[model samples]
Target: MQLLALGINHHTAPVALRERVAFPLEKIKPALATLRSIWTSGSPEAAILSTCNRTELYCAVEGKASHETALEWLSDFHGVDVSHLAPHVYALPQSDAVRHAFRVASGLDSMVLGETQILGQLKDAVRTASEAGALGTYLHQLFQRTFAVAKEVRGQTEIGAHSVSMAAAAVRLAERLFEDIARQKVLFIGAGEMIELCATHFAARRPAELVVANRSAERGTRLAERFGGRAIALSELPNRLHEFDIVVSCTASTLPIIGLGAVERALRARRRRPVFMVDLAVPRDIEPEVSALEDIYLYTVDDLGAVVREGNAARQAAVTQAEAIIENRVDHFMQWLDARNVVPVIRSLHTQADEIRRTELDRASKMLARGDDPQVVLAALSQALTNKFMHGPTHALNHARGETRDQLLSLVPTLLRQPER
Candidate 1:
């Protein structure tokens, strides 16, 4: 089987193209199953990582499916024309694929360098893929090691210490609006990791109240409990919207959950109180028109990129060390992959040896049954098995007449006896 990674990210494609290919969390499992049915031929393993910044498919296939095949598959799966997607998509194979995954998990490939959230996002993607029955041994190992390398990089290097993350940038932006964050009521929509992260950052400011609104009440309750807040169904947002001073929303819903009219109504209800809103969802949970309202300040992930640039210089300085760590880990992962590739050869050799042993043991048993001395039969069986195992190499060495023969003779004994020794 070969490893492949195919995707487009913020660097290669505009948000418009990225959103077209983006698989919302709710659709991932069905998409994976469909992909498996189309490409994996009943036993394919795939993991998809889809975020506001990137949408990537990591997979292992048994046949000769090259990078182009992966791209074509993605194009077809997304109902996008192959020609249209060809320009924006990137496909990495084998070693390059491993390297790319490691870099991504380490946040070396992020738009915001050393952003820790991508690592957790990757883990969640892997988990979701596994639950969907799309993850196989190769991808499972790849992600496991990818996560390990990320942890190693984070623990051993100062890569993340000086970096400014999107969550921190959001908090910074919010501080600019309110004199004191302690007085603001923060509302988070969608109970996913991003919302959890935004809640964590805003919660640190000791906001007067924290509210989690989600499509699923269970998920919303779970997330709300983390911040000692209450949960509200998304349906209640329209009636309760005016209560929040700061609203951060990221959901997989394709349509805008918070519309322009809702925000306008909320603004009027608040008596023109300035409201800070962050829409981290790609399709945009909050309508774009909401940004035009004078009393409501709205920001998307793209807007946060500007605020996230504050510590860029410090992060750039640490990039050299981070790259070195990622490269080292990539090399280590490749070595492990190389060892995995040789497993079948090693297994075949062992199988051949076992066959010889079985044949010789059968011959000795027959001789003993015919009343031959047990000790003599056993000795002959051992000698015959040893000679049989070494026969091919010994003959090749003795009959050769060139440097090839000399090289084989020199290496044959070591190759044949290494395991035994």
Candidate 2:
């Protein structure tokens, strides 16, 4: 089987297309099962890494057409047209797959360059795959090394230094729209890690009122308590939406939680007062239509790209250093993958040798049962075993002509030699 990395990311596709192909957190395990079922040729192994910026499938599949097979599975599962997706999708095989995994884990592939959040997201994906029993030897080894390379990159280089996190960028954007964050009421929709990070950043600015709206009251309460804020049910958002001047949302909901109608109602209630909004979710918690409303400033994950990429130029040296580290690690991983590919050949060779030994022993046993001379039989058995073991190589060397014979002449002694102390 060959290793393949297939998906579309922010670099290759717009958020509209990306959100369509994204796998929700709860859907990942079942999606993995479905993907495994689609490839009937071999015992295919797969792990999916889905985040705000990308949704990637790392797979170990058999056959020459595995890449196309992966693309078809993705298209069918997500219900996206092949024509719309084929241009944006990248299917990386073998070493390219290894390299991509390493780069992604090391934060080189993030929208926010060198941001550490994608690494955590990747780990979560790997853990989920492990729980679903979707991981096998190939994927298991790939992620382990991917993590190690990330740790090494972060430890040895300044790739993450001077980076503007998504949270900080959101705050920066909010400041641009409003006179002061301290005077604005901030409403965060969701209690996931991204929400928590945004809350921490916004809380540092001391917003007048901080509220967390979530589907789960318990999780919202816990998150709210951490930031000295209050929690409310997501259902209550429409009634309370006008009270907040800033809204930031990141939720796992497949559909838009905040519709244009709700925002329009909120705007009417506020009497044309501007609301700066950030939607950090993949599928998006806030509606795309909300961005069109007058006096409303809305930004999606892609809209925040410019703010995140601000300090990247200054860190170009560090990026160069990180790239060097990833290259070395990718080479090492490919070497391991190459070694793994030959394992069956190694097993077959050992099996052949064992068969020869067993056959020679059985012949010697038969001779002893017939009352043959013990020393003669023993010598004959030894000779027979050696001849049988060497027959293939001896025949090949004798029959081979020109360059092939010359090659065998140089290789035979080393193949036959025992290790020296």
lDDT of each: 0.86, 0.91
| lDDT against true structure, model 1 | 0.86
List, residue by residue over 29-98, the lDDT tens digit for candidate 2: 9999998887788788899988889989999876653778889999999999998899999999988999
Shift of residue 232 alpha carbon in model 1, Å: 6.3
Q: Cα RMSD (Å) per model?
A: 4.7, 1.9
Expressed as tens digits, the lDDT of each residue in 128-173 for candidate 1 is 9989988877888888889888888777777786777778889999
TM-score per model over all chains: 0.76, 0.94
lDDT of 1 at 53: 88
Q: Give residue 364's lDDT in candidate 2 (0 to 100).
A: 95
> Which residue pairs in model 1 clash with each other?
none
TM-score of 2: 0.94
Worst 10 residues of 1 by lDDT: 34-43
